[model samples]
Target: MSFDSANLERAAAWLAQIARQRLTARAGQLVETDLGAFDYYEDGSWLAHLLRRHQPSGEEFGILMLALSPHICPHLLDTVIAEVRPEGGELPELGGVRAAGHRAMLPTGETAQFFFSGMNMSRRFDIEGMFLADHWFARDRILWLESVREGEPLMSGRLIVNPEIIEELVTGKIGRPAFSMDFPAEHIETAMDWDDLVLNPLTRAQIREIEHWVKHNDTLMDDWGMRKRVKPGYRALFYGPPGTGKTLTAMLLGKHTGKDVFRVDLSRVVSKYIGETEKNLSRLFDKAENKNWILFFDEADALFSKRTDVRDAHDKYANQEVAYLLQRIEGYNGLVILASNQRANIDDAFVRRLQAIIPFPMPQQEERYEIWRRTFPEQIALAGDVDWRQIAARHELTGANILNVTHFCAIEALAKQTREVDLRCLEEAIKREYVKEGRVM
Candidate 1:
């Protein structure tokens, strides 16, 4: 996937040739250019591999090259356009706009039309087909036409290539995107493995079933020809008490199945303005649709809660948001996991649509004992009198609480200049956890 300047150079040359020929033809002159002689498909470079796989038409290749030329050869289009119009006047047929801080002319949908179809309005439809919603470029989120002002022609929008795709073409890999208002989801990972997770047999079995869907649902739907009958994506509900390994289980699921897990930030997702919630979620789902990513909607009740009777305008729009979310999640092609403290918080409509609802109850005494035994770091030592069994039997602490207590004990031991966490330290740490939870020891 290394960047190959030669491929980009060849593409730029081809596009430049097309621009010259089209401009000449439009200027009351006949131009015969054998564009078919161009050979851009011969190599092991990233662009060549992409061209070979997608096999775009000559005109479609020109559009892609034009979109990419901004990054690789910034002055390519500017030079060609300047040659065509030496008087330094704008050409409306070659649609483009000057971007802030960029000296070169950025291509727009109209620019693509001019390059490919020239003055032939009939052939413009053929160029339009390349930007259709179902097209590979759009579906894969590689490139698209940006939104334009209301009443403006769609072709007037800027032709945008995805930054990730550009990075892949320039660099060897695509880095994880940063979490922001636009994305509203964070890429989450864990070094812990499945063996580290302690779940009940029922929950474990249910999780295994989800893993099956992640690993082989493609085969069942495509190879087995069940796509027409079965839904496109897998929807699962993970509900239980906080700190009961809900999030950890999700991270572990992604780890075992080799899929990235993204936790949607509800605070960023739910907006006060009308239609904003749907807009935010739409951006999230649109970016995630083609990526086989596991969307972990933690504390999902804020967005997917039970809808209320329409008592006010707020209530009606809230219900509409829920409806929109349902449609979006159901249509998503990958796994969607909604994690909440309780199943009752989610709407019954969502519950009915869920393929699996797995509960992560608080750990039992035995599980808590195991958690306590494994919670402490390997470098830390437990005092001889620190009876973990009795501690687990007496105090009910979730895995997260156990880790918190262990962290406190480790810090206390370090403060006292000791290598060991004594039973008294453990007791004090456990008491602090209870106090934080408003529970009496």
Candidate 2:
């Protein structure tokens, strides 16, 4: 049978059995109760028909599954279906099952007090309830339900299952939460390595440490329990001037370690509302917790700046935000790189929490020469008049600046209808870059 058909049959059979048992028990008839044979509907075949009938869109089903899987269980789902599907009715209500108590007559001749009791015994009981209560489930707004009525011991809310959950259950793959303002791996896969990066001794050592941490993270934390004694995460600071390769280094670290680099957009994270920033950050950290992604905060001074005296409400809230960030940073077991233009701009207290603080200084003349030479594509012919030493010495540019100059020179050479990048073109490009920076060439 095909995937959908198979699941549909399984769901129909499972639900039919549940419905028969439910009806028989209601009529005070003997019900077979062997739960060993009735395996937990692991494949989510039980909801396949209901989902197909209600939500025909496949993409919608996938999305709903991504959001609901973390908060749903098979027994709860079965109970929900049983409550809505009447004995001889048409389609059941798609809104959700009412949180009314429904007894499950087990196949082993044992009575489960409530259908939800079976759900409670699966994996982690009431864990989803805690997650739902704390997090804003309404934000996804896929699973809408009524508020629990007073004196109702059972949860009275409606449990609207999204098509995504059904799809996931059928496929057996739980999707990650769709978090806003966080870049995923696919977004940064095309990031180029800094071939011209001139790493000093200290920087090299720090990079090694980061690599070791990533490789042996589980051993140190789980096997050794070092994480329990100290902060679980490796926090580092990349402080340097613009165009000095801080951002590139972070990306390279992620690439080398086979981890995704999520560059946090501080503009989106730091909000004007009091608690909103924390809420946004909480969502980010929570989603990224177990996912081995390196959290890269570029231009981190904006958020990690020194705490000021509380002259007003803004200052107090700002400090509170910093404190909350510190807590989250300490709790995270993965790698987090905070890139800042100036180390002084970052808080002293925050700096104390770091495992490494590698400074990215401006490339020296020799390094600059290397950068200029390496950055120039071998495909592009260099004119005999083009002087690498003169260019590198005269214009003390960062690796990034050198790249920009090379690109402009190439384009200029192309525009002039020449394959060779001549001295005039290179000089003019370098001069233009300096001029753009508000500096006299």
Highest lDDT: which candidate? Answer: 1
lDDT of 2 at 168: 53
The lowest-lDDT stretch of 10 consecutive residues in candidate 2 is 105-114
Candidate 2 Cα lDDT to native: 0.64
Across residues 1-441, which tens digit of lDDT does each residue of candidate 2 receive?
Answer: 334445444434554454445443533333444333222233345344335435423223322332243243335434544565545342221113323354321111011112212222341233234225443333333343344568843333434544454555455544544435552222243356645467665776778888888899788777888866776779999988899888888888888888877788888888999998898888777667756778888889888999999999999999999999989988786888999999999999889999999989888788788888888878789889988898778887887888899899778777878788888878888888888888888
- The number of clashing residue pairs in each candidate reads 0, 14
Q: Which candidate has the top score in TM-score?
A: 1
Q: Residues 54-141, candidate 1: write the lDDT tens digits.
A: 8777777788888888888899888887887678875787788898899789999998888777666677877888899999888778
Query: Which ranges in model 1 have alpha carbons more than 4 Å from their true place?
Result: 26-38, 41-45, 84-90, 378-384
Alpha-carbon lDDT, every model: 0.86, 0.64
Candidate 1 local distance difference test against the native: 0.86
TM-score, candidate 1, is: 0.92
